[model samples]
Target: MSFERLNQINDYRQLGNTNLYVSPFCLGTMSFGTDWGWGADRAESYRMFSLYVERGGNFIDTANHYTNGTSETFLGEFIGNLRDRLIVGTHYSVFTQRGDANSSEDRLRKMVQSLETSLRRLRTDYIDIYWIHHWVFGTPIEDVMRVLDQVVRSGKILYVGVSNTPAWKIAQGNAIAQLRGWSPFIGVQVEYNLINRMAERDIIPMANDLQMGFVATSPLAGGILTGKYNQLALARQISVSEMLARIDCTTARASLNQEIGRLNLHNLAISLELMEIARQIDRSPAQVALNWLLQQSDITSTILGARTSQQLEENLGSVEFQLDMTQIADVDAINPTDSGMLYGDTVYSEVQDILLESARVVDLNH
Candidate 1:
């Protein structure tokens, strides 16, 4: 592929098939408060916000329950006069209020309450995108699409998205919406990063096939991909490095050590690779990680979280350059994306030939 990367921040991409265009990096507001006991103060939060906006970032991400709502409050003050220029997104996923557990009506009430609370905190009349943060097993997907469609018609939310949800459910929900004339989900958000390519197996592909944009959250894999962390994985047992010192890379062993989480050798190896490549490219590891996610064809945007102005600056600088296919191949070699069961590309392709048994078949694709 040609290796010239357009200047990001100002480089806006459409959110799925929607007309609304947003920056490649969606500034996540989860770190915009001290209410969480460990985040940027008000002054620092404003600095980061201003820094991101000055760089031409137009999308800001938030949630109603983030830091018990302090995140939305601070973001509201920061976004005072520039409300119309930015695409504001907020979430309502956690069950926070007392409501009847009977049916979709009660659930809708809770959802609406959460949305209004977020709006009041955000100081916005209408949210650009209202994301149903996740799919709970209790509430039916049909109810969610209907309620979201109602709100969209009422001008409370311009578009609705699904985040932290399964591919099948999102497919089912969007299909239901399309068939019933309700507003289909235009986008999806999921935890995706270099260390965790699990989404590539299903979520990203599903979103792409459905014409829905995929937003990658935790693009740094909870900071493990930053290449500057050494904190041990906490448990009564040994640290991940120590536990992984045994060097059993078998599938069963890997699954058994899943409790050690993302700090395993393979993931850390990915981090080391990023560091090496960044050294060669003269970019920060954080920037390398972000740029890798940005280059993925299926990703619509990547949510970038920063607690300091320095971090924001470094991250914004990532878009000014591009990684060649060789670097991308090196990164992919660390962990080949599992294509899951019976994938013709990654697994058995001969099944088709066996089934056809030398018979000529016309290939008609929709």
Candidate 2:
């Protein structure tokens, strides 16, 4: 699709700060290369990129080690001179095997230098948001913050975001930065889905309190909530083994399977439920999953990853409609995450148990 066609995908939402407007869904390019198997081929990647941009999706997420820098290389060519149109976030601190170590002081300088290299590869002078991909060893929190501040001040990076960091640790970093008068993180990125709500115990509340943006990655739980694999599983030709082999068996998938088995006698029952919900809402299962994330107060953007334009379009449908209170309640009743069920909130849990037991009884009879 051309840029004009892609711009028609305009769905915008306000971030914590009113000045920054972001699309409800941000495209994650971690699957741009073939490192972990299964990614967009070059043509497909270009199509997805163009379609996303045309659809008014300006935020893009990527990492240095994704598919061995194939992601960045592809993005460099993909974005071309239109880099200024996208709010790009590229990560680091995950892979360093090819480089040498540095002293404490040099480490901070080196980290900035590494980001500069990333900028070069990305064919951009500045990154809208720079994320510390993962926590690394031997790097002090203070050093990391100090260098990050320097980069922002230098205009190499406009804002700093942290991904895969503990809630308490992130809180500590921000607190230190605040007390010492340094730039604190404006946003956080983490794995969140209906099945994996562990982050809610602390991350959600903390982010809300601090007014930090929360970006949910893997909102579909590694395609489990997409209803694709479940559809295949129903035929008995494609087992969970096939899914594991294809998608690396994410925590989301494991939890989904366990929960589905615990809830219904057969997994197809849950897929049928999702499919029914999708039909009722006039959206796809993937869209319903993404929409669920958008319903949260603290959730700023959902990072959607797809290896094809078709997949991207499917996920984008999530931004189409707001779920009614009844629909939201129905979904919550089935998938109770830790945060959704507070100590006194036992109504939904009780309902889930009754329904599960009833289904089990019926299955036994059959």
Candidate lDDT values, in order:
0.76, 0.70
Writing each residue's lDDT as its tens digit, candidate 2 over 1-366 gives 001111123556555543566776888998787666667778888898898898788888997768778898899999987776777888864533322444222256557666877888898888888887655434568877887888889988888888776777788889988887878888888878765676777777888888888888878766667777666655666665564345434543355455444222233445557767888867887777677677765678889888778888877776667777677777665656544543113233443343233232123334
Score candidate 2 by lDDT: 0.70
- Give the alpha carbon lDDT tens digit for every residue of 123-242 in model 1: 989999988875554456788789989999999999988776668878898899999999998999987887767777787778878889889998887766777533233342555577
Would you list the clashing residue pairs of candidate 2?
6-54, 6-55, 7-54, 9-55
Best by TM-score: 1
lDDT at residue 93 of model 1 (Cα atoms): 45
lDDT for position 206 in model 2: 81
For model 2, where is the 10-residue window of minimal lDDT? Answer: 1-10
- TM-score for each model: 0.82, 0.78
